[model samples]
Target: MTSSLFYHVSGDGQPLVWLHGWGVNGSIFLPTVTQLSQYRSYCVDLPGFGDSQPQPGTIDDWAELLIAQLPANAIWLGWSLGGLVATRIAQRWPQKIRGLITIASSPCFMAQTTPPWPGIAATVLQQFTQQLEQDLQRTVERFMALQAMGSNSARDDIRHIKELVLSKPLPNATALAQGLEMLQQTDLRQELPHIALPWLRFWGKLDGLVPRRVSTLLPQTPQSQDIILPGASHAPFISHPEDFLHHLRDWLQTTNKGV
Candidate 1:
């Protein structure tokens, strides 16, 4: 179990766990995590990503493994597909998390015109899945570019993301495809209310992948707040680090006071 997953811990104070998005590893959070000196950050490389071993199982199976590896009773921060896992943990083991923060994540990640869900189109994800088989590096790089799409600093953002991604081991091909599938399949709308802990949602006004419109569509939960960055994209923390941290730190300070 010790080697099943990998987590890097830094900073010192309250514990804050960070989970990265699909196609990228936990190391993607380093830029943002390093600036936050208020809390101990446990950045975890989900199975098959970064330094972690690839494990085959549903998200439910993985959550049990995740909480066991990190400090219980810490605030959970997840981005993109990682947010789905964080929400699942909060739903099943509420006591393990004191607060929830999801960045550019949607409860349901597939577009639905009938229900009017705002998410990435199914066809786009399918293309990534198929492309991954042909060219792993190009597929991941494309996805990274998409995250920074529409941001004013998109060029810089994509370069930064690609640099971070290459610093660590590339994700397993299976894991990348599985992650896309998860994004297409997982839905946490009904379970949002169960996360009674303090929750904050971060969105980018220009994000193509988890559109800012999603903020309005999520089910309202008590003690929840949403903030959208005007010049940011899917990876706001990278595209607008200063702005992202401003809102993130301010919310953490206020939540610490109340929680």
Candidate 2:
């Protein structure tokens, strides 16, 4: 069962929901929404992030909880960990998602036991988990820096991320731990082919977290497409909103035209 999640709704048009990456909340997308003003946007603070209360469960559990509160049908856009949740929704309840967009995300976030996967090293994730117990704030800040590591405007990018994180209530300790566990254990590679929705994946060529190599390995559906922003890092939308929006608007327009 899922608890009521906190969200900010705005604009008026086709329903478009925004899901932020791990460690940050909905506010991080505030700067970019103006560019998407043509659509009715719902920026969500996933279960335990931002002001939402924490709920313990697996990725599917999080998806089920979120699906219950979403519009019957909407364009679902997710980033990083939120992307995993959004993909889960696309898989479990395809009827609810008109389209799926994933930013700086991978079907599998960690290396598999058999086939090699492009993702954050297991040791790096483990360090984050261990550090969280010692200094939650510092650990989160470190994660924020990692997201902007390869961007040309890395300092500004980190500032924006930190500002957004500080703008809301800090994520719950349990939620942080749970999110790390999800990143470390969740592997959706085999499940990717099962998703039938029109999917668009956006990546940062310089992203250290979700490497570009992962995109090559993702399951290719007939409607799947990907774009990588040069000189951008994990948070391409944050670092280069205009460039990100350009491609996004073009894709949406083209997709709409086809319909």
Candidate 3:
């Protein structure tokens, strides 16, 4: 397997690959994945974050690298930026990726009114991109705060996410910059309707970023449905992990029955 990025495999059952949000590593899912004993989890650090040290590249570059390291027919689950990457992987290699799960993510992240879209304002991300060049810590801290904002346990969520970010090697400015660029320019809504594989869209009712409204606006796929978790924010798994797991297991069971 490729050793370019850091990854861990645990438990034993159907394979599950987890990709984390920007600014943090895959270990952020440890608390919840550890409880998903039914899945043979493969949690990996995306390039430029955690122990993974490689030049930051485009979304296609990311998908090719990650898919090469995992088994075929495995389920892919991504959060925020990671979700975008996973979606690309499923599109690029539909045979390898059997199912898709996205949390707090949107195909078109840049908000626009021309096509009637819901997403992040261009100015806010523009500011973050500018600030990333100056102070990586402050910029990431601010982004983290934005993520935890609007959650019922907003204060506690920020503190916990901070601890996770601090525990690993921070992603370089270039990585953060490139990630923001992807968030600003990428749009996959036009492609969602074409994918034939199963997809589950997870959302937070209180999310400040990637508003729950985006799911409704997404092009509906044949095997896709959106599950909005009440009282959860940007990080639904972090806010209510057990509830998250409950839904996941139930869905997996339902999916397997058809197989």
lDDT of 1 by residue, 150-183 (tens): 9999899899998987899999988887788788
Candidate 1 residue spans exceeding 4 A from truth:
1-3
What TM-score, computed on C-alpha atoms, does each candidate reach? 0.96, 0.97, 0.96
Give candidate 1's error at residue 23 in angstroms. 0.7
Model 2, which residues run further than 4 Å from truth? none
Candidate 3, clashing residue pairs? Answer: none
Candidates ranked, most accurate by TM-score first? 2, 1, 3
Whole-model Cα lDDT of every candidate shown, in order: 0.87, 0.88, 0.85
lDDT of 3 by residue, 121-164 (tens): 89999998888888898888888888888888889988988887
- Among these predictions, the greatest TM-score belongs to 2
Model 2: lDDT of residue 196: 78
Model 3 TM-score is 0.96
Residue 10, model 2: lDDT of: 85
C-alpha RMSD between model 1 and the true structure: 1.3
* Location of the lowest summed lDDT over 10 successive residues in candidate 1: 54-63
Q: Backbone clashes in each candidate structure, one number apiece? A: 0, 0, 0
